[model samples]
Target: MAAERRHAQMNSYSDIELFSLATQFQPANYIELLSTSSVSTLVGCGQLCNQNVKCRTFDYDSYSFMCRLFEGAVETGSLVPSGSSTSLVGAVRFQPNLFAAFGQDCVQCTNSRYLICSSSNNNTCQCPENTIWNGVKCKNQGYEDANCSNNQWCRQDVEYRCNNMTIIKTDLPGNDLMWNTTANFSMCCSWCGNHSDCKAFTWISSPGMSFGMCYLKWSRGGGGTINPGYISAYY
Candidate 1:
C-alpha cells in the first residue's frame, strides 16, 4: 500500500536525517533572504533556527552550498562538487565528531511533550497543556508581514509615514549616531547595515530635500527602552 511504503521511508532515517530532507524540500521557507538582483552570496546560519531543519546550518555563496553538516552525520568521501564557469569539481572528505544519536527523525524531538527545535539556545517549543508536537509545528509570533519584521513600526520621535505606510525614522546628531543622505531604499539599507547604532531605519522615497535621507533609530520594540530624542520633521 502507498501508506505502508511512506511509513517504511519515514522509519529508515533518524530524526536528523528526516529534518535535513524537510529543509531540502523547502530551503526558502523560514530564511531571511538578502538578495539583490535575484542573487546574493551572504547567507545567514540563523536561517536553520527558523526552519524545520535539525542538521547543521549551511551558507550558500552564489556558487555553492557551504553545508555545516551536524558533527557526525557528515561522512568521509562525501562529494561536494564545485562548478567552474560550468565545469564541476570532485569530492573531498573529512570526518566529523558527532554521533548518529545526533541524527534525527523529526526536525523537532519531543521529550514527553516539549519539542526541541534548534541547537541555537536549545530553542524549545512547549506543547500547550493537552496539545502536543504532532504534525504541525510552532511558528514565530508578532511579526506577521511577508517578511517577519514583527508588525511594529520604527517610529521616530515624530511618526512620519511615507505614502502613509512606510514609517520614517529620525536621527539626532551625537556620538555613535548615524544619518546619511541616500537616493533610495537600497542606499538606506546599506547605510543602516554599515552603522552600529542603526538597529532599524526608514527613508522617504521622495522628501522635501533634493535626495532622501536615511534615518537611523533604535530597535525598541524587539525589547529595548525608548529614550528622549529629536526629530527634524513633524509627523
Candidate 2:
C-alpha cells in the first residue's frame, strides 16, 4: 500500500509527494475521497497546499472533510460548482478568507491568533508541535535565530524555507555555483542556509536517487517541478 498510504502525510514544512498529489485529486470531483490522516480538517488541507509552491488554489468540504488542491490561480467565481453538496468551498492561492453557503465554517479555529486546531482535540486551538505561524507560513520556532531552546543555529535569515517533494535545477549547471551529491535534506538545508553563495537547495529521497541526493544552487532557477521525494526550498 505504499502508493495508497504514500499519500498519508504528517503536517510539516517538508514532507509530501509534491508531484503526484495532483493525479490523486483530479478525479476526486465529488466522490468521498478515501480517508487519509494527511488532511482531516479544512485548515490542514490549506496548510498542505500552503507548503507547496505550485498550489495556486484549494477546495475544501467541511461536511466530507475533503481537500482538493489546484495548481492554477483560479477565481472562486469560476470554480466548478459543488455537485449536490453545498459544503464545498474554494479560495484563491495564499488567501485564507472564503464565503461559504449551505455549509458550515471550514475551521473552528481561524483568527490572527490561532491558525491550527488540534486533530486530537478539535476544539483546542494550537499550532503543530515546535512550529509557529510566521504571518505568511508556519516556520520552525527559532529557525532563523540563535536563541532556540536547542541553540541550533539553523539559519541566520528569516527568509529560509523548506519545500518538500520539490526540485530546483540551477541555471548555471556548468558553474561551481551548483552541485549534487548524496546527503541528508536537512544537512543540505543547513549548508545552503549558512552558505553565503547558496540561494536555493533541493533534495530527493527515492530508489532512483540512490536513497537521497542534495542539489544546491547559488541562484534562483524558476519555479519548482514535480519530483517524487524531492524537497526544494529557497531563501
Candidate 3:
C-alpha cells in the first residue's frame, strides 16, 4: 500500500525525459542557477526542479548523480560533449499559483487563516494552522496525553509544566531541521519556543542511541501512527 501511494505521488508531477549521454549547455547565468544533491533518476531530479519556483532547467550527472537546477532558459547552441555521463535532462515548470489546481486561491491564502505565499517557497500552498498536508490533502491535527514512561512528561491540564510530552496525531508539514542530537528535553522545548513557525515538536530517544533527535514542525497535520520511541508536544 505504501509503495502504491508513493508511485501515485510520483505520477502526479510533470514528466521529464533525460538525454541518453553526457551533454553540456552554455553556462547561461551563474546568478540564476543553484546546484544540489543529485537524485537517482531524472524523474526525481525533475520533481525537485518543479517544486522550486526559480528552477527552469536542469542538468543531471548519470555517474555522480549531481543535479543542477537553473532559473533561466537553456541555450541549445551551448550544448557540447563533456565526455562524462552527465546529461541535460528536460525541465518542468509548475503553475505560478501552485495551489490553484488544488482548489485554493492565492488571495485567500494571504488571510490570517492561512500562511502567506512567497516566491522563495515556489508559491506552494501551505496547510492552515492545526491542519497537516497529507501529500494530496490537508487534515486536522489530533492530540493525546503521553504514557509517562522513560522520563516522558505527564500532562497536567490546569498547571503548565515544562518537558511534558503530548502525542500529536500528524507529523508537521515541511522538512524538519535537526536542531541538535545532544539536546535535552528542556533545550528542545526552548528551541521550539524560540522559532515563530514552530507549532509542535517531537523528540525520539532510544536506549542504544547516543543522542536524541528533535524535529520542529511548521504545520500540525498527518503523522499516521504513534511510535513507542517518540514523544510529541505542541506549543
Candidate 4:
C-alpha cells in the first residue's frame, strides 16, 4: 500500500517550527481556493523540481490535513507562516515566488522570455498564432530575431505601415499588460495606433504570458529604441 499510495501535503506550525507533508498530484495554479475556510491552507506557486512528476507542497491548519495547490512547487525558503491575525485560511493568496519557482535551476534562461527548463524536457510556451517557434521562445508573424525583437512589426500595407512595433507603455505603470484573452496581434496594433500617447508596443500570446490578454502602454517619455520593420508613424 505504501508504494502505490499517492502523497498529499499538509502544514503544521508548533512552537515556531513548521512541518510540511509530502504529496503527489500537483495543481496548475491553486485553481479552486476557499480562502475563507476556518483552516489555513496554502500551496506552492511553481511546478515540482527533481521529482518524478508534478506535485505541490502545502500547509494546513493545526488539526486539518489538506494539501494546498500552488501554481507549482515550493522552494527551500519560499513558504512563510501567515500572521496570527490574518486569515491565510479561506482567503486565497498567490505565492510571492511564483515566477522564480518556474525559473529555478535554469542556467540558460537569462535572455529567454518564457522558456522554463524542467528536469523532464523543457517547458512549452504559448506563442502567437501567426508566429512560429525559434528553438528557445515563440516569434510572431515569421519573425527570426535572437531575442524576439527582430522585425517584430511589419508592413500592414503602405498607407498604414505599423509604426514603432514592440513597444512598452509606462503611463499607467503596471496597468498596460493583460493576460488570458482572445485578442490578436493585429487588434493589439490597431489599439496602439488609436491611442493618443501610445509611442510603442509589444504583444505576446495569452496563457503563457499574462493569461489571455494584451498589454497596451502609452509612453509620453521617449528615448527608447524601435524595431526594424515599423514605419515610424506616431499614434
TM-score of each: 0.22, 0.26, 0.34, 0.21
The lDDT values for all models are 0.30, 0.42, 0.49, 0.32
lDDT (Cα, tens digit) per residue for candidate 4, span 78-176: 333343322122112223222333334556443323334545544432322332344443322312111133344321221323544533322222334
Tens-place lDDT digits, model 1, residues 1-235: 0110111111112222212121211111122222212223222322331132333223233344333322111221112332322211111111121121122433445442223434443444342221123234322221111122222321112222222223323433333245676544444554565565665664443323334555665552332233222222211
**lDDT for each residue of candidate 3 in 42-66, tens digit (9 for 90 to 100):** 6677777766644556777768877
Q: Top lDDT: which candidate number?
A: 3
In order of TM-score, best first, we have 3, 2, 1, 4
lDDT of 2 by residue, 1-235 (tens): 1122222233443233322121223211111122333357756776766564444445566566666665433321123334435234333223223111102232654542224555565455444444444444433333321223343313333332343323343222322355555334544565565567877666655442223566677765556556545556665
Q: Report model 1's TM-score to 2 decimal places.
A: 0.22
After TM-score superposition, the amount by which residue 27's alpha carbon in candidate 1 deviates from its true location, in angstroms, is 12
- Model number with the top TM-score: 3
Backbone clash count for every predicted candidate, in the order shown: 10, 2, 3, 29
Q: How close is candidate 4 to the true structure, as a TM-score?
A: 0.21
